[model samples]
Each structure stands twice: as C-alpha cells, then as structure tokens.
Target: MSNLFEGSTFCIHTFGCQMNKHDSERVAGMLEGLGALPVDTIEEADIVAFMTCCVREAADTRLYGQVASMKNISVREGSPFNKRLIAVGGCIGQRDGAKLTDELPHLDVVFGTHNLGSLPALLTAAAQEGGHRVEVLDAADDFSSSLPTDRENAWAAWLPITVGCNNFCTYCIVPYVRGREKSRTLEDIAQEAQGYVDAGVKEITLLGQNVNSYGRDLYGEPRFAEVLDAVDATGIERLRFATSHPKDLTDEVIARFGTLRSLMPALHLPVQSGSNRILKAMNRRYTREHYLDLVKKLRAVVPDIALSTDIIVGFPGETEEDFLETYRLVEEVGYNQVFTFIYSKREGTPAASMEDDTPREVIQERFDRLVDLVQRKAFEANQDEQGSVVPVLVEGTSKRDTSILAGRSPKNQTVHAPLPAGVEIDELIGTTVSVKVDEARTWYLSGTVVNEDA
Candidate 1:
C-alpha cells in the first residue's frame, strides 16, 4: 500500500465555501502523507479531486460541465494523463454518491463529507480493483478539522468549533448533507488556536454552519462567546467567524464585539428576508424587527462596527411589498457589504416543493435593486475611511496591481497600500501595518503607510 502510488502528484479543485476549502487542505495533507506531490494543473497530476458544494443549483451544473471536460481529457485510451484517478468529495459527492459514478463513468472514486480521511484508501482501492469506489459515510466518529492541514495561507487558518447545522432553514441543504450539529470539545478548539499561533498564524476564523449557536448541543447552551474569549486569550492578532444566524446571535455573543480585543469588528449575520411573513414562511425563527433590534444592539455596543449580511431577494411567496421591506431594511441598516442571492430551489430543501410563482423578471429586478443599494452603502462605508489611519493585516500584493500590496482592516475592508521604501511585499504578508487611507472605492481602499514602525 505504501508504494502503490508513490511519487505521484494530485490537484484538488475546490468549489463553494471556506469549509470546503478547509476540507481540500486536509485532503492535500492526507495525500502528501501518502507521498503525493501537489500540482497546479489537473493535466499534470496523477490524481484529480473535486471538493464541491451543493448549497445552490448552479453548482450541480458546474460540476457536470467540469466532469464532462475531465472525461474528455482523462478517459482517452492512449492519453498521457489516462492513469489519473478522478475523485469527488464533499457535499455534492455526499449527496449524489454512486450516481456520480453512473453519470460520469470516468470518475474513479467518490467520498463523502464525513469520510475525507478515507479518500487515500478509496483511491487505492480504485487503482487496485480496476473499477470505481464509493465511500459515503453517514457520519464520522471524529471531526475532519482534527486532520492534518496544508494551509494555502501561512498567516491565517480556519478552526472549526462545530460542524453540521441545527437550524434547518427550509431553503438550506447543509443539515441534510452535513448532518446534525456536533460541537468539538472546547479544549480541542483552544489547543488548535494555540497551535495556529505557534505556527505563525496571526489570524483564525472559527468555522461552523451557525457559529453563534456553537456548544449548544454539547453544553446545553451556546458558548460561542466563551470560545471567542478562549481564542482571544491565545494572543492571536485577529479573530473572526462566519455565516452567523440572526436568530442565534444572542446578546452575549453580540456583547463580545465590544469586549474581545482580538475579535474583528465585522459580523456576517444573514437575514434571509426582511418581511416577517416571508421570514416565517422560510422558518427563519426570527422576525424582521428582531433582526433590526440585534443590529441596533451591536451598533450600540461597538459604534464603529462594520456589519455585513446575506439577503435572499425572492422567496416563494415574496410580494412587491415584501421586497420593499427588504429595500427599506437595507436602507435602514447600512451594511458594509451585502451578499445578495436570488432564491434558487435546492432539490432536497422544503422550499423546492413550494409554489414559486414569482416571475423571473421580478426576482431579477429585486436582486438588482438590492445589489445597487448594497454597492452604494459599501462605497459610502469605504469612503468614510478616507482621511483616517486604519490597521491592516497585510495579506500580500494586490491581484489588480502587483506593485501595490493589500491587506484587510479591522473592519475587514480590503486596504491596498503601496510598499514602503526598500520593503518587499513578502516581508509584510503577515504583519499588521498602519495605513492612512488616501483613496476609497466601492470594494476596497488605497492607502499609504502612516506609521511603519507601529
């Protein structure tokens, strides 16, 4: 088994959320442990894997297209990359299982969300059997976050405090595919944070389906605030989390924004819809007023907090008035950014079966309106940063201009700064720098170093 595929290389193309990206890192770590090298292109690799997402319908279409392309390349009898093993894993793999193999005959292996550890062995089986293998586990005894990781970014890491979802919003497919809520022991999480710090990681975002509800299944109450405190005590420079449900964002959790020194000032609370009627229909468990109230509390505690949110523009029964309420809410609470989505019916979700008679034009119009409002607010927020000195965690050179380095401010705004004299961009990839904002755009800010020594 040790020499089965020695000296081979693998390329993993990951699609979807950060969790899937983290999973791909673990996969790479596992592959490297099996004596595999990482390759940039699938054409040059002996193994190709896809870590997929099933959150939206388009992912399925994209997956099919990619597989079809791979089939053309890898399935040829005399092709140079003919020996490559094509593996599929994550939510899409977990959802479709053997059907993926049936649909795409060239696919060699399919592993599930809970069985990322089994991938190497499954590939081995596929190679040995001269046939395909499917290893889709309902759940795993251990968390995938515990596996070795080959992090792409040296300055940051994702530490999963919990996995799976407890809040099965009718439109969501996460709980079905990712399974029920399971919180990692607090000790494990804290220890992981300390490890990241020791490894030169300056920032870590705690990962979960609903981060604010962390520890509820195990501790009988949500202890996310305490988790934040534990990680903050590790002396990590920056802390953040993602996709927090508006209902589960308790006052204690919101209060931590003001108290935790390392915690970033940005929050991504997703309020799916703005009308109470639409909210109840989606089983969101919180009303529009409740969400606005939480926003007020967050601002009250931390006046300069930068807020962002997710907005679903068109649900099954959303009315013109319902969309106006969403528009009103967006105007009422100016978000630093809003991730707008026109509702797409996922096959397994309850919403897929409901009547979606809302015209496509209406949905598109609402989506455009929301997008415009969000962009305006974001531009205004960035503009406000002008004539101010903000601390940014330098992430490396900007993709748009290599001469200009970029980093993120405490509020999670991208601040692109010119490299100071005789300083290389690589040297500041992980350091915090004080940047004086000189220019502000809708999505980012351009600044100069205000205090290099600071």
Candidate 2:
C-alpha cells in the first residue's frame, strides 16, 4: 500500500442504491483532492475501492466473487503496479469488515458507513505504513460531512437531506444497519442546493431514508414541502426524488409536483405486497387499498405523473391468491417500471424467524410469472409514448457506441442520439431536447434529437 497521493489514478466500483452512489461521489472528491485522478479501468489505478451493500444476500455474494477475482489476479501475477491497492467500504464493509479482512488478506483498507470522513486518513496511513485497517466506528453515529465530493456529473447531484431510518420493518435491514434518522439542518440543505446551483447543477434530488418524514425529528414538524419550495427558489432547472413511503406521502408534496415546474412527474412508491395480510406481516403499516388511494390522489394532482412501484413476489406465507392480487394490482397501476423481487430472509430480522413454508422453487416460479406480467405491462406503457415527443437531458455518449450521445428526461427516461462536436455536458446536459419516440424498448427509447425544438 502506498499513499493515495502517490498515485495519479483510482477507480471506484459502486453497488446498491442512490445513497451508495452519493457515497461514491464523496470518495471520488476525496481522492481527487489527494491528487488521484479517476480511472475507468482498475489496472491503471493506485487504489481500487469497492462500495458494497447487503440489502440483498445476492449483493453480498457478488462482492465475495469480485474480491476473489481481484485476489487471484494480483496474488498470482505479483504485480502491484497493475494490480492496484484494494479497499472495501460502505454497508457491506460495516457488516463484514473484520470477517472480510480475515478471509481476504489482500485488502489494504476497510472503511464503513460511519467512517466516510476518515477515508482519506485511512488511505494516507495505508499508503505510508502498508497493511490493513478497519474504521466502522459505531452504527448509531451520525455522519456530518468533513469530506469532499467530486460529483461525477455537474447537472445532477444527490444531496442527502437525511440519512438512516427509524421504521423497523420486519423484512428490512435498513433500521439495523443505517441507525436512527438524523435530519441535516434546513439551512445546511438549502445552502447545499445553492452550492450545487452555483456549480451549474440543473437538477437535485434531496435524498433521505424517508424523505417525506424529513425535519420531523429535528424541526418538530414535517417541512419537506417548505424545503422543496426553498430549493425551488434557488433556480435549479429540475427537481426529482425517490423511494417514497405510502404512509408518509402527503397531498402537499403531491401538489407541489404539479405546480412546481421543476418537480418532475415521476415517483417510486414501494408497495411490497398487494395483500393486506402480507403488508401487516412485513410491518409496512399501510394497506393495499390505502396505497392505491394515494396513487389515485397523486394522479389527481399531477395528471401525467408516471407511477412506478416495488413488489415482493413471495413473503413467508404468500398464497397463490396473494400473488394473483399483486399481479392484478400491477396491471391496474400500469407501472412504468416494477422493481420485483422474491423475498429473501435477512439475518436478525423478524421475517427470518417466521416460518417460510413457501419453498424456493415455488417463489422462483411466482417471480418468473410476475416478471412476465411486468414486461407485458411495460411494453403497453411504452407503446403509448409512440409518436409523442419527450424532453431529455443528454448524459454522454452511449457506452455501446461513442458515435451516439445519451441522456435522460426529467422523468429519468434514457435517450440516445448522435454526438455532435462542440457540444459540452453543461450546455446540452440539462437542457431539454425533443426526442421523437420512433423506436421504443421495454425500458428506453432510441430517437433522433429534434434540433429546432431543442
């Protein structure tokens, strides 16, 4: 291990959700400040960091496989120059830091969710002394920023308004891992949005474990709408947010999306199961009818708002009827995207203790059926967008072909078109370009950019 500053290139492989993506940005900023440039390939890096997650057991397994490959490549080749210094951090690091180090001796540093601020210091020590270090600290501690964040893009940024969760859902590990909810000050958040605006950010998603419950623990009341209005005043071109809980969503929040031009017409609400019994078993608090009613009300406020949802196919005691109810609900809503999953019992969660009589083969069968239904619904939904023009934000050249540039709409639909010279991300990144939906895929659309309308 060598000082992070000693090398000029580093690569980061981030897993999990937008929160983890934000964490990666923070790490990138710190690395850049330490004089390490970002490298897309691991072979050319001085440090290679893996930001991991354990929300799903599959994610945990994925990390181990990656670690094994890295160890094999570096140990067998005996080339530190090309191998790069390996580091593991984030949620998986918090859960399995010591165990990972004991199992894989090649890792140079291990940091956790609570120790993001200490990443630079850990890298410094690892480089100078050469060995392994773990800095998880405590799970309950709040992370107040004393770190840099080299945001991967300028137009879009994830500003963490709050972190952690208080709701102890029977099927979720977030409460156990992320600790208690801690809302950052309103001034801090508003100021952060202003900073992003100053940095040419056209859009900002105020992120949190439970966004609608923001400021309740600190400001003594729900101030999400107030904060939204405050951020809107900053003149950011677009606004978006995610993962809203059904119980916490309010009319005021829904109404703002309609009135506030920048608030994009899209929201992802997780209705884990359509059956009330399963919802109760999962400690979700809201019923299926209640969620549907909420969706109806949201549509009333924002007529064209795209609805997306999450569905868990087989909870412990799910029956065929229960699965059918979910499928029917999926059809009824006509979700833009359905994040479907078969339940995986998390360790230390109440669901793990409950009798999961539903066999894996049965769950797998149901999951496959659910996915098939989602695809049919998705195709139907995308077909409606045919001949309709969509406003999209040009991201960059498509990964598959550099001859074409790609971007997303305010609603986050991916669009690809030819890359014209002299066009920069800032000039065309956030600006709306009319994309004719001549061709549509299950999730994205391929269309030529309309120059006059843009």
Candidate 3:
C-alpha cells in the first residue's frame, strides 16, 4: 500500500452489531496505515466512510438519510469537506453493490464484507479514477482478524473466531451476503489473544454469528469449547462470546461457563421467537422446548449467569397464543436483558413471502407488553446485585456525567462510580476495580469504589 493519500483524514459512521464495529476498526487501521488521520465527524474529514448494516429496514433508512446529508455537504459552497470522498462498506455494500453508486451519485467507492483487504486499493482507485469504484468479492479472500485494527476501547478487543453463517434462517439475509462459514485457525486466534494481553487488553470477546458452531468446517466437529480454552490460556483477564444459536449450543460449550475462570458469567443467545410454530416457519431448527432445555443446562452449571436474548414480536402469521407463549417464556427465564423487535420482512428471505394477516396495531401492542415484562425482569436482575461488591473492569468516564467513571461488572452490567478524590482518572481505566453496589437501576448500577486493586 502506497501513502498517496498521506495527510488526509477519515471518519467512519458504523451501524449494527459488534462484528460491524470490529470491521470499522480495521478500516480505520488501514486508513491510518495509508497515512490518514482519524477525525471526530464526517464534515471535518477528507473522506467519510459508512460501515453499514441491512438487517432491518430502519438501518437502510438511516443510511439513506446520512448519505444524503453528506452528499449535500460535499456540494455546499462554503463546506470544509466539500471534496470529501464518500465510501460505503460492510453488509449493505455487499448486498447493494453497484446499486449503491447508482442510487447515490456522490458515492465514491463500495466494498463488500469479504473485501476489506481490498479497501486501500479501492480508495486509491476512487481517488485516482474520479469515478464510482466498486469491489465486492463473491467470497471472503481473507479473514478480517488478519488485518490491522484501531480499537476504540483500549481496555478490550473483539476477536472473531468464525465468519459468516451456515444455518440459513428464513428471516436472515446473512447467509446470502456473508456466504458460508469459515473458521480461523486456532493458533492464529490464540496468538492474537496473547498479543492483546501483552498490549494491556483486560478483556476480549470472541465474536461470531453462531459461536457454538465454530471449527465444524475445519475439524468436522464444533470446537468452540477448545477455542475458548486456547484463548483463555493466553492469560486474558476476562473472556466473552456472543450471538450463539440455541440449536448448536452444545453441552460441552455450556459446561465452559462454570469451569473457565476467565469466561464471564454472561451469555447472549438469540431465540427469535418462543413459539415452536414460529421457529419452524423461520427455519431456526430449534423448538421452544429445546431452548428451555439449553437454558436449564446453563443455569445448572452457572446459576448466576446473566442471560440475554433477542425476540421478534410479530412474525408474518403470528397469533395471540404464539405471542403469549413468548410472554410465558420471558417470565420463566427472567432474562437479564431482552432485545425485542417487530419482524421486518427482507425481500429475499423466506419469511417475506409467507402469508400475513396480523395487524400492525396488534403487533405494536404486543411489542409494548413484551418491553414492559423485559424491563421488570431487568430491574429485578439489577436489584439482585445490591449490597454486593462486584469486580468492574473500568472502561472510562460515564457519558452522562464525566465526574463518574463507568465500567462493566462481571455480569456485563454497566457500573458507574464517582471519581475518587485521590486517584487519577487515567489510572482507573483498564483496571478491574471493586465497587460496592449501593444503587441499581433497570439499565445501570451506581456505586462507590471499595477497592482499586481488583
């Protein structure tokens, strides 16, 4: 890569999951490697890139609005970033491809999910050719972990063990956009974790669409448990993984929670709907009974595990009974957090073509009720932490009040403590400090520092 764009700066507006966030970090690292500086806002930068997500219609709508605003700014007479290059990357770019350039005439470049390594060359071409340049690979040429990353948080980093999805859920477009599953070599992952620990990374989260299915492609069997063991051996302070599929969450994997010292007592397993009828229609491959069984195994191993999940309120043909089934499951499980959504039909997904007679008002009502139950459960979970001194890995100063420093407890709950009189703010970050939980709200916990050497 040549430094032809040296002295330039960039700002990346990212949307969607942790994977997308990690991709944006790698993009920033590549730009900086090409001698570009990082900027706070799009208007202040020479190039503004969007790491987009197309999982829902809302994401698409947001992208269109943001790009339109940037396009107008580029043409504005007195704008500082009037000549800025507008680039689109990630899932939306992978899906939309040349269509994005056609839609947004101001769009300078488009690169796909698997085409991140090609970004430097794509940017160079866009700058030199002065035309809309697009490069989206049919399949992943290289794993993103192989690329450099400019991590936003110094305390932690995201290590993806697997890329793409094998289970083609009827409602998800991931398989079409991200292609088949590809597992990273175990040695490469472990080495990376060691490097992060050496760089003072207090925690690391292994990322994947279905982390439980990791290593099946390579070894002909799921080796996520082994992957966890290898990474934890690197001496990392804390470990976490996300977005597990209930169908593939093996007993061996569930057993890791209680045994692995570094593995935090938290899991985010998405069960789109609790109704077996809805799950079968969605091609989720797991029934309501199976999900509860997995939950049972998890609790049996790690009783205090903070469980979170994703629930879609209204599918195409969902009935009141189906919705009530979900309500009952939420009550039974008492999830520490619940991400509820009204299902949006994507054009290519099977669920899109399914017959739907469910009314919009009914869906909205169900969504509100679900939210009420989830909030209550969340508050109860937080209340359980009262009077407990939890080990919180300090992240930084809280957003609402800078005087209070914020960090995540072992359960991944946000814990904030007032900045102590004697300690410097910088010293608190990346260090696991013990805070006696004095107050607990539905969303966060407030406490005072009891011990700094945690």
TM per candidate: 0.97, 0.93, 0.97
Ranking by TM-score: 3, 1, 2
Q: lDDT for model 2, on a 0 to 1 scale?
A: 0.80
* Model 3 agreement with the true structure over 1-454: per-residue lDDT tens digits: 4557777888999999999999999999999999888989876788888999888999999998899887556432433333778899999999999999888898899999998988888888778778888998889866998888899998799999899999999999988888899999888899999999999898999999889999999999999999999988999999999879999999988999989989999999898888999999889999999999999999999998999999998898999999999999999999999999999888898888999988899999999999999999999989999999999898889888888999999999999999889787798888988899999999999999985555
TM-score of 3: 0.97
**Which one wins by TM-score: 1 or 2?**
1
Q: For candidate 2, which ten residues in a row score worst on lDDT?
A: 74-83
Please give, for residues 166-256, the per-residue lDDT of candidate 2 as tens digits.
8788988876667777888888888988888998898898888789888898989878888789889899888887657888988899889
Looking at model 2, residue 219 earns an lDDT score of: 84
Per-model CA lDDT versus the true structure: 0.89, 0.80, 0.90
Backbone clashes, candidate 1: 0
Give the residue spans of candidate 1 off by over 4 A: 74-82, 452-454
